[model samples]
Target: MLTRILPPPGPARMLIFITMVMSLGQGLWIAINAIYAVTVIRLTPGQLGVSLGITAALVLISSVPLGHLVDRAGPRTIQLWSFLSLAPLTGVLLFVQGFWSYLLVTSVQGLAYRAGNNARKAMIAARVPAGDRARIRAVIRAALNVALAVGACLAGLTLAWGERVGYQSAILLTALCFLVTGLLTLKEAPVPPVPAAAGAAFAVFRDVPFLLFTAVDGLLSTHGLLLDIVLPLWIIHHTDAPRWMSAVLLLINTAFVVAFQVRAARGTDELKSASWASLQGGGCVAAACLLFAMTGGAGLFMACVLLTVGALVHALGEIRHAAGSWTITYDLAPDHAQGQYQGAYKMGVDIGKMFAPALFAWLVIGHGATGWIVLAVSYAVLGAAVPAVVARGARSRATAKVAAGGVTSSTVRM
Candidate 1:
């Protein structure tokens, strides 16, 4: 377990270190940014929401273009920019007074990070063997969990006293982290030479099977948000469970992710295995929904027990989904156009982020616990389709050659 969970020393391991440094900074920002915004920036809730909305929109817009650049130039160069540009962007937070400055700086900051992350995925595909990519991603994800945990804990000190000083210190620390990581990336992260590519920027859209696969992946990305958003509401409004259970659900998620992500990643190298893993994830989610529904109108102990089981099941689904999705994202991408492919893949995730919250709320909040039944049925249907869809994606991946803005008809799902 230790061997599997711990990344072996190499570029992947070093990459993990870089990931840890960047993640720690992000963790710090996540812990304090909201309070800091309220206290230091004096921004309204509307401004904050709009700023984040614009940031998400920018990321969606840039995903493909950044991927194209990554393919042409190389992921290392893009990541170098991700790290470097963020340093200055983060610094601009100090001067932010109104919505405009906050939006300007935060949007730029978010875009840089998004581009870097998309490039980082390409970089992993480039550097790590396909068989190892899931495990390596697991390591990175685990490290991020650890970093965020530590960062959040440390940020609590600031929360206790010195609100203004604490906010500035935390933001400065975040900026410094980006600077230090950028410097380290420049000095140490080895850049593999990019292979030349000639293809249409929109070639990914032409691959029907890949698009289908990406659609599944995008939906899969919403699993994390379930615990963060949906579960809380369900506990509050639908279930007899206490609101505090939401926090417990998150803790369960983080603990399981840190403990079992690598273990869950095992045997995901092949498309069939990955598809199977994904199916299992969907089933877990389906079962979890049922359990969550059962939490309604139950005795206190039973409701808590049912919710716990549901959350734990959801965590497993999250782990399985992560491993399976990471496998396909790396395995199916054409090496020459990895950046573009990854960018396309990321678009699916962004789609989930942009839409899943609203969709889930409509399903549950508007419809009630019966809405969970609807979700469960849909998840099972989607999960049941995985094997066949994967079989189709496999054929396409085997025969598909992306040429200027489209794929061959042979690559389309049969």
Candidate 2:
């Protein structure tokens, strides 16, 4: 059973193990950070918001440069240093007293986290076979979700304990997780750095088709905020469903992803299939939005049913979207520049998320069903456009190859 679910004993399995450990730490931090900031640190909600915004901005600013560094310095070496940096940075969170200190610590932590993530993706590109990359990513994501859930449960226990010591302990434990992940990274074989040509450090920015696809894909990725931020508010304020149903919805989404994500990822190794998966996934999410909108003003039983069904559909979309996005990002990038390309993709997603909370609050929570309809339409339109966008990217790559000289077999297929 373990073999069926996990990669064989090799670098891929090692990577998955590292991902699980890292995600466990993130899960603990994410679950309790806001409460710690508000209650322990005595920061107001507005101050917390500012800190988060600044941290995100710092992540955006640092992503490309750090990823470029990963390419030049080697993925394994950069990833080890990034993880080591995170250990101290996260530990410093235990000492945050006010907004400024909190902001400074978290901003640095975010940058280190982004650098580690970019290097990890590049490592996968370097180590995993092309045919297995998407599947392995899906497996890693599944492991991540499971580990995060476990970590969140651990955080919950700390919250229930209701002591300053418990919170501090969780922070220390998360720091330890980072340290362990860094040490574990040492076991993986070293990946050679891809030397970059002078004046071509940021060439990915010039790939217009890739940038466009990243933008559209980033917009679609905002569906996550819908589940995390929008749904809880919608259930509590608008729908007749019980508040606990929100937790239930999250459980359903997590379980479905763990069970089906690898299966959904199958066949996404190719551009055409991956594009189709994105379209289909988008349609499912759009349908889920419409379903969720209908829950407004519904009776308790009817609302519960709609929420359950919508959650399942949303999870389906989530996994498919993830699989397709991984493939597209991997395929679109050149072998030598995977780190920077992945960083660009991460930047796009982060930019979308930065605005998603406010946007969803205004449109979905503020405007109610109307907001939901707008989101549905946006997802559907964007999802339908993926195929064309992918084709255009393929054509552009092909043109570049031909212009350079004779087209490669891969270019001919594109």
Candidate 3:
């Protein structure tokens, strides 16, 4: 169990260290974003909503093309830029005042980070062997979660120290961290080199099952973006929750990732089993969304408890989904086309972030939780159906190959 959870030494080890540094910076930013948006920027929930929506939108547009770039230029180029550019964009946040300016800076920051993140993940997936991919992915998730946990703890102290001082200091520290990691990534040699011809965007679309899974991945990504953007903003705006509650929420969400992500993602190599795992995780997150809707007017203490439990369940599902997706994605991707598949995967993840926050915000404000509830129900439905679809596709693919070779008459029996 320990060995499975711990990444083995070599490129994987270096990757984890670099990832941890990046996550530390990200964790600091995320841990504070809600509070900063509300308190410092004086942005309303709706503005915050739009800000995230724009960020997601940009990421969605960039992911596919950027993936192709990674294939063409190499992941090293993206990683270097992700690390180097973050410093100025994030540091400038301290100086920005109004809504438009803040949004611009933050969006730029998001785009830069998005490129770097997709490149890093693609590179990691490329380097690790097929059998160990789940464990490697899990290790990366756990490391990020651990970084989030650390940031949460520090954020609590930072807030107490002074809001402006705390936020500026945190951002600066985050920038420094990114710089170090970016330099480290530059130092390391490339483990996988994608073919130049594979640089064409949309190469992964040819695989029907892979494409289908990416659709589900898009939905899942939307829910994740909404949760990250909406929940805290809603709490701060609607309820009189203590500011420290943000740290509590962050801690709850990341704790499960640190503890159980790898374990839940185990045995995702079997396509059918992996699909089931995605459903299970998605169901858990959808249920949590419902629980949040039902619990109205709860004070900070009760909200904290409910959100923590919900977050734990959601994290379990996230781990399973991530593990299974990574496993299946690696299995389906042609060896030469790994970068393209990874880019497509990133595109799917960004698609949700693109529109979900703004839509969820509009629904909640224009309609009510009814809108949120409708979305939640849709999430549950997809959670249930997605696995069956993926499984069927996997089975069909397997059987068609056997039939082409005249090995088996029935798809399932084969």
Candidate lDDT values, in order:
0.80, 0.90, 0.71
Q: Residue 295: error of model 2 in Å?
A: 0.9
Looking at model 3, how many pairs of residues clash?
Answer: 1
Candidate achieving higher lDDT, 2 or 3: 2
- Please write out the lDDT profile of model 1 over residues 1-414, one tens digit for every residue: 334566667778778878878988898898888777777898888878888899889988888888878877778888888889998888778888987888888888877887788778887888887778888898888888877877777787878875687778888888888888777666545556566655555677887878898887688667677788888987888777788999888888888889988889998877778888889898898889888877777978899999888989988988887787777776666777788888888888889889889999999878877888988887878777777877887776666545345564322232
Positional deviation of 251 in candidate 3, in angstroms? 3.1
For model 2, residues 1-414, the per-residue Cα lDDT tens digits are 235889779999999999999999999999999999999999999999998988888889888888899999999998899889999998888777888998888888888889999999999999998779999999999999999999999999999998999999999999999999999999999999998955577878999999999999999999998878899999999998899998999999999998999999998888888888999889999999999999997999999999999999999998998998888888888777899999999988998998989989999888999999999999999999999999898787778767767554452243
| Tens digit per residue, CA lDDT, model 3, 316-343 | 6677777767766666555555666777
Worst 10 residues of 1 by lDDT: 405-414
Best-fitting candidate, scored by lDDT: 2
Most accurate candidate by TM-score: 2
lDDT of 3: 0.71
Give the C-alpha lDDT of model 1: 0.80
TM-score of 3: 0.77
Candidate 2 lDDT (Cα, 0 to 1) = 0.90
